[model samples]
Target chain A: MAAAASSSDWPGRYHHIDQILDKPGPRTDPGFLAGDGVKDFLRGQAKILVIGAGGLGCEILANLALTGFKDIHVIDMDTIDISNLNRQFLFRQKDVGKPKATVAAEFIMKRVPGVTVTPYFGKIQDKDEEYYMQFNLVICGLDSVEARRWINATLVNMVDPEVPESLKPLIDGGTEGFKGQARVILPGITSCYECSLDMLNKQTQFPICTIANTPRLPEHCIEWASVLEWPRVFADKKLDNDDPDDIDWLYKTALNRAREFKIEGVTWSLTQGVVKNIIPAIASTNAIIAAACCNEAFKIATSSAAFLNNYFMLIGTDGVYSYTFEHEKRQECPVCGGEALDLAISPELTLEQLIETLTERQDIQIKKPSLSTPTKQLYLQAPPQLEQATRPNLEKKVSELVPPSGEVTVTASTLPFSLSLRIAYTS
Target chain B: MKKNEDAAAKKKPKTSAAQIRVQKDLTELDLPATMKTNFPDPADLLNFTLTITPDEGMYKGGAFTFSFAINTNYPHDPPKVKCTQTIYHPNVDLEGNVCLNILREDWKPVLNLNSVMVGLQYLFLEPNPDDPLNKEAALEMTKNRDQFLNNVKSTMRGGYFKSVQYDNVLAR
Candidate 1:
């Protein structure tokens, strides 16, 4: 607190900005990042949106405000909890159960005058496309991969190369205990979030046989409850974990199953953890990760320093190790790069099989997909009339649908980007 | 009486989305051999108790109990877990709020009660001094490892560790 007193004052506030201030005496050539007015550019009306108001979000907001940004918007659907006080520095005991976004914004506005932070106390999906377009940049401190992917897909879809202003750079940060990473995502120019599917590890899944016939771990029992018993008993009632009655039914049923198998140690809390897939988090990692993200944001906004090429990987375990490298763009990136996707399929495979295969692919996911060739509209997923017409295509062989090794366009209501598949029949 | 009965039948308790997920999750729980679960009432899925008798660690041969309360928004939100037994440990604070990540900020829709129990069990086996909810206990564990062990054993035997009284967790 004593050391921060120097920078805490208005007069000594911009002292840290000296490090990034460009040199006056230019030698030969200057780039976009070079020269004066860097300070003015940062202090300019550049609007930034920060996703998540948890550990990382709390630090990112304070960093952005201290880094000379004027207009900031934060969106989070969570309220403060008692455990958050350990790391979430901005909040107090009284603020528990309060909307994180609203409380965070009000705190910042009170602390840092001249900074107007509008907080959205809702999910990112709640807002329309137009609402996101207003921001100069979007910084995400989100914990979930699903939320990250949604935000990534939304940003990629929103990118129009023709409109320079529409190019929203999504700077993302994630922290788990001692490990964290920050990445700079240039929607159309550099690799988008969807470009690198390999970076995200496959979600752990147990075999259906293991979960059903022989359940060893608690996770297996939970999976059985989710995959089998839920549908068997509560077919009419869609399972929602938030509901106490639904949970109660599942718990009793699972307990009965566990008792029948003579398995020990099944609890209601255990069921919740298995279903939720919770991870570990700490304050130091959140602080370190958020700082990296804010640093990248400052560089990107003011061009004070060259922004992270693509990814900045960090590991705080054992010892702190960090490296920055440019992640290459995939030529056939579904979200960003629009081109024909090459697929190797068997001629004997039916449209149903191919649709199943495409849906399961790691890079691309399409639910209720439709296929069409140049000459014929092979299948359609929408409209009662069209679905009835395409019902025959499911049984039709792949070779019969189109030439053995030809191309077809795929369309789906859920997909943000359509695909043109160039198929090569193997058998 | 007839009118009241009709009103009761008409106003059925609306089931929540979280309850459905919780119901699904509860049927699949896999807990450890050392621990057992007890529900005060079979109808109440949200509140339950967990009893653990660790075979190994500083709190060895000691019994510990914890109470869990799941909110209506079970999967999306984490359940509140508290230690029923007062003990000297770095993770579990004096007020019974345990310092487990899954029980707090690390919580997600995919995590279940089983994972939380394992985590809590691990705390007894190898308490983390790095992230401490109790500063005094953390200092003892990190600064003086031997003294910390002694303090834990003494406290478990129904004595004071740092002038703060703890219940006898040892199996009598």
Candidate 2:
């Protein structure tokens, strides 16, 4: 442990962290005990699980390591791309095409000695509850909404009132084009990611007729080329948005279509951006958001100071504005509320229509959902034979399939936990 | 369990919200005698056809057939309407795509199949020269009305215009 090492060994190495952990001031947490043992615990015991190795992940990993967190694990399913070199400072030209988690782990551990970062080059879903239960806390820098929801549900489900250690603190950070947010979610104690699901912006979809016929904008032309022309031209193959050749073909096709319509502004970068749905990322935003997340993690782990209430949002586009507020836990939150969400529908609505409503609802977006009542299964999207058998039930009226209690359980491929819904038939 | 599943699969299919709404729309339809509808498959009300024969217009004697496919997202999303036969009109393209505002941008959940039928019929009665799927036809209509009417008559007779052959939609 670093406690046994004499302070003379490393003159200024532990000086900064020592000053904070060695003494308590006016704003220190009431539970804080100033001593060398706090530093030792941070250096030897605290285990962290970081959920991405992209822009914010790289910055968070570096900040966590420098903040005296010794044991760290990171999970990233993406490989390093040349485009990521602009903001993900941990990766270089030589590191392109390598697993992001592995390269990031190697870079951080090499830069800072005595810090061990274990990299998982796979999806976070691949790891089970037991794997997550071993960690002291988890920090997320993931950009995918589905992944964030899955992890949030998993962590919330792992909590047991009887066991204290099962309650893992989750620090999440995200950044996009000079705007970012950092929040702390204490599994069962505070508001979770699911509680604020409506905060996310809905995906923009161009109308099919607009893209197919009257395209007034460059994005509309790009959508036409990618959505309509690509499928018609390449019947057997799918467009790989990452490949330069595919993007070039789309750009040329869009450019030609734009010229036919006498429209302008069809560029290669715009084609790539439209196809990949790339958000503009800035390095400074990532660093700031990551540092905020790490600061929350540090305070939560050591209790040297009061942690952030729940959410902190920063908008740097107009002269650096920021705000911190407490996001209340929703009573109808499917994950932490422990109450079935109430949904009112017409009694004449068929099972298929009900399923469509569930899938389309922004707050309860579950892809390929299987539903079941207490006594009978309404529909199942899996296992060929079962799916075929339940397929007929899709056409049946929900009033006929569900019991008088109107309680149903929905499970989906995108979620880690089943959703409980209380259906009310509106006459 | 396997036998039970097979038996369940063989049972009668139930109606969906889209089917219910479509049935309601058909029952309440107030179409003129010049317009008619047909169901290719009686069991499937979601997919049907509408034929409109304008009474007094440039396309008076011509019968235009449009196929409508309504999915489960009906009312929220408009039905997929397409001309069954390619015709030369300002609003209808060479590929039979229609350019009706109600069918695309102005669609609302309150709008029903009857509304769409009326919109389609109105296109034949008065083809708007502003929003055109066929720019050449729209331009002809705007620049020289007589020449546009000639092109429409010739195209309806299964003749060629600008090296493009159109389907014979004229009534027998």
Highest TM-score against the true fold, candidate: 2
lDDT of 2 at B165: 83
Residue-wise lDDT of candidate 1 within A1-427, one digit each (tens)? Answer: 2223233346656776755565523321244444335555566557899999999999999999988787899999999977678888889999998999999999998999767789999999788567888998999999876577668767775654557887799999987668788999988788877666446643466644455556777666776787567875665787887666777776777777788777866788677656665456778899888999999888778765567888998898879899888998875454566444768787899998988998998787668676665445566653333456667989988888766435576756445435667666675
User: Model 2, stretches more than 4 Å misplaced?
Assistant: A1-9, A203-207, A338-427, B1-172
Report the CA-based lDDT of candidate 2 relative to the real structure.
0.81
Q: Score the docking of each candidate (DockQ).
A: 0.01, 0.08
CA RMSD, predictions in order: 19.9, 10.6
Q: Model 2, A1-427: lDDT tens per residue?
A: 5653333236679788888899998889888878866776777788999999999999999999988898899999999999999989999999999999999999998998877899999999788777898999999998887688778877886775667998999999998889999999999789998778756653466655567668999999998899767866886798998799999999999999999998899999999999998888999999999999999999988889999999999999999999999999976455676434667788899999999998898886679877765445577664333456678988989988764335676766454445667666777
Model 1 achieves a DockQ score of: 0.01
* Candidate 2 positional error at A257, Å: 1.4
Displacement of residue A92 (Cα, Å) in model 1 is 3.4
**Model 1 C-alpha lDDT versus the unseen true structure:** 0.73
TM-score of each: 0.55, 0.64
